[model samples]
Target: MAKLHLIKLSVGTETIESLRQWQAGKQTQTADGLPRHVTRMWPKRADELLDGGSIFWVFQGMVQCRQRLLRFDEVIGQDGIRRCAFVLDPAIIPTTNALKRPFQGWRYLQPADAPADLPAHRQTEDELPASLSAALADIGVL
Candidate 1:
C-alpha cells in the first residue's frame, strides 16, 4: 500500500481564491461530491496537523514519491481573518530509482504513513531526496 504523509504548505492568496472557486464549482456540479463534514473538519485538522515536526509524503503521478516536513503559518483568508497555512520542506525525494514505475498523473501523497529514517537529502517535490534514493536502492528504483 502507498504510504501517506501530511505536508505543511502555505496556500497563496491567489491559490486560496482558486480553491474556493473550485470548491464552488464542485458544489454546483454535484451535491454528493465532497461532504460538508469533511470541509468542516479540514480547518481544525489542518491546525493540528501542521504542528511542529510533522512529516508528509510527496507524489508524482499515482506513485509514492518523497516526504516533507510541515511548517505552519497564518494567512489572511478572503474573510480577512488570519487562518492556518503550511509550508513544505523536503523529507524525502522522488527519483527514477525510488519509483518502481514511472508516473502518469499529478497528485501528491498525504503525510501519515511515511517511513521514518527516510533519507534526508535528495528528497524534493521536483527532485528525489537522498533518503528516497537509499530506499529506492533497496527496491531497485534505479
Candidate 2:
C-alpha cells in the first residue's frame, strides 16, 4: 500500500490571494478543475513552516521532493525549549518559465505517496542542476 502523506509548499503573502482566485477561475477555464464542493482551505501546512523559519524548495517532477523532519524554535513563554515540526516540500515548485499558465507561482503536488505520475528522471538528490542550485543559493536557502 502507498503511504499517505501531506505536502506543504511555500507561497508569498501577496500572491496567495491571487493564487486562490486563480484556482477558482480554473473551473471556468477547464471542464474539470477543482470540484465545486472542494474549497481550498487556509491554515495550510505551509503557513506553519513559514512561522517556524523553515524554507520550502520547488523541484522538478513529481516524487522529486522528499520528506524530512526537522526541529524549529517557537516561543512558548519566557523560558522553554524549541519544538519539533513536520512539513512537506512539493516535488516541484513550478517557476514562471516552467509553467504553462502565467501566474505568481504554483506548487506541484501528488495527493499522496502514490508514486509520482509525472515522468521520471534519474538524478540523485545531491546532484541538482547547477542552475537550480544557483537559483536556490541566490535565495539564501541552499
Candidate 3:
C-alpha cells in the first residue's frame, strides 16, 4: 500500500528554522530523545502511518516541512486522559511551499496530494515570502 501522511499547522511558528528550534528543546522530545507531537486522537490507520509516513508541517499558511513518523506512543496527561504521541524523526525535510488554509487539527494527506520535497539545491535557497509562495502555488508554479 502507498504510504500515508498527516498535515498539521505549526502554530506560533514564523519560519521553518523557528519550528526546528522549538523542537530542539528537550521538553518537546520523547524520553528517548526523539521529537514528538502529542494529540488527543489516535489514528485508526496506525500501520499505514508507520509504513514510511511523515508528519507535514504547515507554517504560516503554507506546507513547509516534514518529519518522518517513527511510532505512536500512548501518553497520559496529569488530567488522567490518554493521548497519542507521534514520535518523530529529528530530521526536518523542507518541501515545496504549498498553500494551506487554517485548520483546527491534523488531517490525513494522501501520497498523491502531499507536496514534493524540495530539491537539495533549492533547499539551500533563501526562503521565499509566504505571499509569493502562496501565489506561486495558486498558479501551480510551486
Candidate 4:
C-alpha cells in the first residue's frame, strides 16, 4: 500500500526556523528524546501512517517542512483523558512550498498531492516570505 501522510498547521509559527526552535525545546520532546506532537484524536489508519508516513508542517499559510512519522503513542492528560502523540524523527526536511487554507486539526495527504522535497540547491536558499512564496506558487513560478 502507498504510505499515508498528515498535514497540520503550525500555528503561531512564522517561518521554518521558528518552527525548528520551537520543536528544539525540551518540553516539546518525549522522555525518549524524540519530538512529538500531542493531538486529541488518534488516526484510524495508524497502520498505514506507520508505513513510512511523515507529518508535513504548514507555517503561515504555506506547507514548509516535514518530519518522518516514527510512531504514535497513547498519552493521558492530567485530566485522565487519553490523547494521541505523534512521535517524530528529529530531522526537519524542507519541501517545495505549497499553499494551504486554514484548517482545524490535521488532514490526511495523499502522496500525489504532497509537495516534493526541496532540491538540495534550493533547500539552503534563504526562505522567501510566506506571502511571496504563495504568490509565486499561484503564478506557477515556485
Which candidate wins on TM-score? 4
Candidate scoring better on TM-score of 3 and 4: 4
lDDT of 3 by residue, 3-103 (tens): 89999999868899988888889988999999998999999999999999999999878999999999999999999999999999999999988889999
Which scores better on lDDT, 2 or 3? 3
Model 1, range 14-120, lDDT digits (tens) per residue?
22223334335542222334311111113334444444434322232113333333544444556666643333442223323322233322223344433334254
Error of 3 at 53 (Å): 0.3
- Positional deviation of residue 101's Cα in model 2 after best superposition, in angstroms: 9.2
Q: What would the TM-score be for candidate 1 when compared with the true structure?
A: 0.31
After superposition on all C-alphas, the RMSD of every candidate to the true structure, in Å, is: 12.4, 16.8, 1.2, 1.2
Task: Assess every candidate by TM-score.
Answer: 0.31, 0.24, 0.95, 0.96
Q: Report RMSD for candidate 3.
A: 1.2
**Model 2 CA deviation exceeding 4 Å by range:** 10-63, 68-84, 87-121, 125-142
The candidate with the higher TM-score, 2 or 4, is 4
> lDDT of each structure?
0.35, 0.31, 0.91, 0.90
Model 4 bad stretches (over 4 Å): none
> Could you give candidate 2's per-residue lDDT for residues 54-87 as a string of tens digits?
2222333212233321222232323554332232
Q: How many residue pairs clash in model 4? A: 0
lDDT of 3: 0.91
The list of candidate 3 runs beyond 4 A from truth reads none
